[model samples]
Target: MQSPLRHGRAALGTTIATGALAALSQAPERASRLFRHRFPTVAVTGMTGVGKTRLADRLSRRASAEGTQDVGSAVMERRTRRDPRMRGYRFRVVPGENAATRLGALDEVFHDEPVDGVLHVVAYGHATPRRTAGTSGAGAATREEQLAAELEDWSITAHRIAGMAVRRDRPTWLVIAVTKADLFADDIDAAVDYYSPGSGSPFADKLDELRALAGGAKLSIDVLPVCAQGGGRKSSMPEKAATELLNRLELRLAQLSGHV
Candidate 1:
């Protein structure tokens, strides 16, 4: 017994309410999409036990609870409460121990779908037992030999990245994170100088070659000294370094994305 006008008004109100509810339901997804568009994926790569995950944990303000080393790969999608602007970084961490996993991760991040940037981590003289094992199963390798092997690993990783850049025909932003700076706190400057570009070391030479291999594409490289776990149990160096690194990383990403 309702009038036509009243019926139409009721139907229209119902439609509007339904639409409002639908939009409200989709707000979170829409926000997620927007956040992803702003903050894209970044690959955190390096040799095993170099503190890549620890650094990511620190940057994302997540507790470093896992004592067991990462074996495969993981994507950290949580937004950091400490730096909201640094939120939403899809930090894909791949294992650096196994050759199969390392190559697979590199291909996933570089060959399959290239990420925004790469953080190639290194810990000076922090050789793992496996890495230091003698080729003939004789004994542990000498410290100098271990250091050489680490540099060789860095070379291989850098070359792979350069190859990917060439294939993608795009600029690449590479940050060489010299982690475990706390181990050499008394001579931090020397440590930084050792790994820095133009230091005349083999590492620097390899970096030069990497840049050359990039051809016309821009290769933005940075060497950062970091202590992902701080100098000691009570040191605040990790927090400070994490903050500085995040700030610099934001700028680097902005530059890479042409948002600068």
Candidate 2:
């Protein structure tokens, strides 16, 4: 029979040997973790009532719900055959243009953790018709003039956000989402033509003004219409718009990941 002291010493030695083996086995995993990179964070910023929260929820594939003034967070994930696991980006839904909130949010983003992109949302319905010289005079404003004026007014917020992104030390890609597309689905093509460059229209001039505001920032900008409403409606317009936004987002992510 073994003495109790001898048995205790043998047990201690076995425990030490097992721990050493475990540590050796985990060394490669620790090294791999050190080299692993995390997906970029995308910050969503827009004026109040622009459906920023709704868009975040939709992008995360969640059911649409009421939006809050407070900042919201969500994760957007995609699975690839090579990884066989879902990879994702963090989405931070920031509050609207309150100076304090906006500044605080940017401060956190810049100092704590930098974001890869900005999903700057602009609401179309908020663009109220602008009073025109023609209306105050002998003539009526043309539909094109009215639309252009409204868009220009609504564009100020988007341009401000874009300019901020451009001025950041590491300029982030900008995705301008013209949300609430369902309201004008019937005239989507007209809106697109009006917003596109070289359309020889005043609205086109406004778009140019926005691009100029970026001012040599090496950042990519894309504008697309979006509808946060769930797909099940008579017009499948919402589904189409959401899909387009997702495709654009994927392209931006690829660029960030150096896969493009």
Candidate 3:
């Protein structure tokens, strides 16, 4: 099925073209409530070297079903996007202790309210553990220890929120986002050339690296490939990918609630 965002957008364009704006205006919220009954929460998470922030930014706009502004490296602004379909439901994309506080704030904001769901964005700039001789290597004693550390971080976030507020019977999703696959892929290419010449190319080794870390997360996750840096520029395919993810999420809610 075509996404409501795309179809509705086309419908909206036709409505305006056919002078039906007056009709749509009378039923403004109708278009927004594509999945009104769902309290669906998605914790967009990944390692520190992944693209959490970018996914959050893109997904936020999809949640709101509106075009959002450009958010990239040149800027370090805190941002939020609220859903009109489910009023007071919003996604917070900022970092730090403020993120925890914002979660609680949203809980209070929607304390007595029904929700479509929650989307948690974790880790913006992160990478897989490189199998290096230095601090960034793969394995416990090598370079990528940071990646392991991040896995724990993501788990903590999951347990802290999903474990507490969500139910075991309910679907609590964790999107194990991998950012900078291009860079990682590139690095792999370089590595194969430098370290294991004639052994294998980096492209051949890319998925193996991704799989290793994701497996270590020990969490059932939707491993979404992402690239957040152009560092402060617009994403290539990620924005579209983000929209599709939101649609899947919407579908998940419907399946669970039988809203359809």
Candidate 4:
């Protein structure tokens, strides 16, 4: 018969040996984790209503659609596959205030994180029309003068935005969003008469202005007309623009991942 002390000692010895084997097996994993602690991220900066959130969601969905798997937190991701889902750049949605706040936020996020690229959106108009083309209560005779002021302001701001981007190290692709197409459409009749009276539509006039603004910025700006909300009895006309924006975003991601 074995003594109780001897039996207890043997049991304790077996437990210790098992723990040692477990620790030995996990040593490589710990080393691998240390290696994975270094990964790059993409910093996305845009205005509050410029569809940044929508783009991020679409990007995630598109990444998964490309048949990417095996994304480990502390494990090495083989960016070799150009998989946006698991690649060199991760996304950090930097929040911003109004237009100026947007630039500020971009600076702060880039300074503190790993940023490979930036997605910036610049759009037009606010809640109000700024000016209207009319008789102007007989006081302001020159309606054209009022319109000129509005356009000049837009042009000035547009240039300022572009300059700020240059200072911030602009991204591979800068998307210029043309928001509020529907609002312009509301003025379609008036606009068609004012700009394109012969036969062209109001949107035709809008596109020209958008193109002009984009050219001013010196960015290969892709115009996206989106209506997150809609007017009564009218469906949005720029639905195609939304698709184009999404497609462009995916292509940009692919390019960054080195897939394209």
Question: After best superposition, candidate 1 residue 158: deviation in angstroms?
Answer: 1.5
Measured against the true structure, the TM-scores of the candidates, in listed sequence, are 0.69, 0.55, 0.39, 0.38
Residue 191 C-alpha lDDT in model 3: 33
Candidate ordering by lDDT (highest first): 1, 2, 4, 3
- The 0-to-1 C-alpha lDDT of every candidate, in the order given, reads 0.68, 0.58, 0.40, 0.43
TM-score of 3: 0.39
Question: Mind giving the per-residue lDDT tens digits that candidate 3 earns over 1-260?
Answer: 99979999999899787777666675757655543433333333233333445555554553322322221222222344445544322343323222455445334322433232334332322343324335543433333454445545544444444333332334333343444444443342333232121334332133234334434233233333344433322544444544454566544434444445
Candidate of highest TM-score: 1
Give a tens-digit lDDT track for model 4, residues 148-193: 4434433433444443444443332333334344556554345324
| Residue range with the least summed lDDT across 10 consecutive positions in model 1 | 72-81
Backbone clashes for every candidate come to: 0, 0, 30, 1
lDDT accuracy of residue 222 in candidate 2: 67
Candidate 3 Cα lDDT to native: 0.40
Q: Give a tens-digit lDDT track for model 2, residues 24-136.
A: 99999886543333445677765555567777766666665443322233322221212224445567766554446655665655445556666666654442232333554
Query: Quick one: ranking by TM-score, best first?
Result: 1, 2, 3, 4
- Model 2 compared with the native: what TM-score? 0.55
Tens digit of per-residue lDDT, candidate 1, span 1-260? 99999999999999999999999999999997677566766778776656777767765667877664332233332323224455456677766665676777777887787776787777776544352434543235555665686787787678778877887655678887777766665666776677777888877778788888886357788777776654434564655654565566556656665555
